[model samples]
Target: MSFNWINESTAINLALALVITLISYIVIRRLITAITGRIASWSSRSSHGWTHYLGEIIGRTSRLLILLMAIQMGLYVIDLSPAWESRVSHIWFLVLALQFGLWMDAAVLLWARSALSSKSGHQRSQLTMTMISLMVRTALWAVVLLSVLANLGVDITAFVASLGIGGIAVALAVQNVLSDLFASLSIGIDKPFEQGDFVVFGDIAGSIEYIGLKTTRIRSLSGEQVICSNTQLLQQTIHNYKRMSERRVLFQFDISYRTPTEKVAEVAPLVKQIITSLEKTRFDRAHLLALESNALKFEVVYYVLSSDYNQYMDIQQSINMALLKELEQRQIKFGMPVRSLEFLEDVPVIQRASSDVDESRMVQK
Candidate 1:
């Protein structure tokens, strides 16, 4: 290469620019640190949740970004050719755009964490937030790229048109996946069921364990994990037991028909008292429903004021035991199916045979 010697003034400009860039980088970094520290201190005393999130995002400011910005400042001290100036301006735009994208990316992450932290064990909200975060970051980087290209004198309309066509092709290729994705998003918004909710759909009953982009995982009562696509899962009706406020209980029992009518009438009152005496139970009605061939059929209706299956079982057991004890004390017997047969003959077979043998012996004597 041919030697190109710089004059004293030009040399001084280059030296001065380098010095300025170094000092500026150090100063900017220190300023970032100081600002982040200040925000952190303020966040500690603030009850507002956004303050802490803001501090975390600010702390993520990149050192490379700071260096680039410092170099941008130093460019003001340099005298350069027109072509170099134009190219440097483009670089400046690209650097600044990229830094902004980074900051926005950090903000998105912080917001997602904050949101997810508030809703622990809820996969619906977490998956929804993650999807949204991905969309936002994608949009941010797209904007940055498009702006950079336009700043460098590239025709973005044709580029965007091409991208649109490609996007359409890709979307068509993954139609099933996209359908499931949208279904999952709908689940997040409509809230049909959430993670950790016990649900029954068709013949399957299980608790939701995880929700993914395309599929939802469930742990069935039989101890196997069920992975069902979001679209298919949503296509069916789901009964969410977690949302139940109370359980309506209807049961029947029978007493021996030998029980007196007066005693039969007392049973309803006894059942009502026994049910009402238990915790979280609301007695609705108790009546002698019908009289069958073998027993008096009684119907009892009540409600357990809880969604807990175990709690409801416990209350029902207590009521059952109490009612049984009361019945035993009152000497009222439970009804059981019974059958008997009687012959319409005056003399039994064995007695007639014995008399026949006795007459024979007397004749012989």
Candidate 2:
């Protein structure tokens, strides 16, 4: 029997294409699974766990691409109108482009992790890697979007002009956010502080808990979390205390003025020896600075051979207690200001004689 375009040929072709599309999907999914499994096996052998991550991203990307292509081919085979077919194709292409960008971004992260493993001492900040990957993906997506627009025969010149005009207002509305984002970028590049570093800016001092796109989270000494804008953090002078291998401890005390100068000199050396003998404390310098209005001033400056704040305070307390006990044992008294007036018998007699002489002079007159 002879067949015409109007009757049955279209339905038969569509059914065949549908079956082929389903078969393609199943085969492609199996291929993706097999490829991912092999990659996981290689990762176990190669000692680079990051490769496993890369494989998973690629596997999913491959499955998506295959599904998209199968759908497009099936639609074309079903004898749809030209306009509808074109629209579907364009949509599929856009989706494919977006997925491709995502896949590329994932690959970038996996590569960065591998690079970090090869090098020793100070890995690249994860925030930095994330920002770079995002920027790269954004640029790629921008290109892909523009390409799709061009394929659809959009007027590129007019679109560029409109974007330029609208961009100014959008920038003004979000300038603060943009500033913070750029500042975050600068921080990632400059690396003034990283996660787990103790930082002090103005009166806000804390250990960095997280570095985000526009803010950084810090855990304060009081155990409160503080979220600060990156723009402000970059603007201030940051004190990174975590980088220091030692901490400096300085303080002053007073001794009695009547204490012998020789004894005062001996006190410094004794204190020095005591501090140096302690664990994780260094004897830097101690001196009898001056005799004050009420008491003699003594200054002690030393280094705690550790960055631990608690240990530093503990060492300082021990030194202070030892010094106080030593002074008491030496019978050196602490100075105190006293105000008093004493009248002696000789002073009274002199005053009486002066009064008598004045009275005799008045009588003679």
Clashing residue pairs found in predicted model 1: none
CA shift of 124, model 2, Å = 9.3
Per-residue alpha-carbon lDDT of candidate 2 for residues 218-336, written as tens digits (9 for 90 to 100): 99999999999999988898999988899988988888878887787788888888898899987889888887888888888899988888888899889978887888998776667
Residue 304 error, candidate 2, Å: 2.3
Worst 10 residues of 1 by lDDT: 115-124
**CA lDDT of every candidate:** 0.88, 0.82
Worst lDDT run of 10 residues, candidate 2, spans: 114-123
**For residues 190-240, could you state the per-residue lDDT of candidate 1 as single tens digits?**
889988999999989999998888999999999999999999999998999
Candidate 2 deviation (Cα RMSD):
6.6
Q: How well does model 1 score by local distance difference test?
A: 0.88
CA RMSD of all predictions? 7.6, 6.6
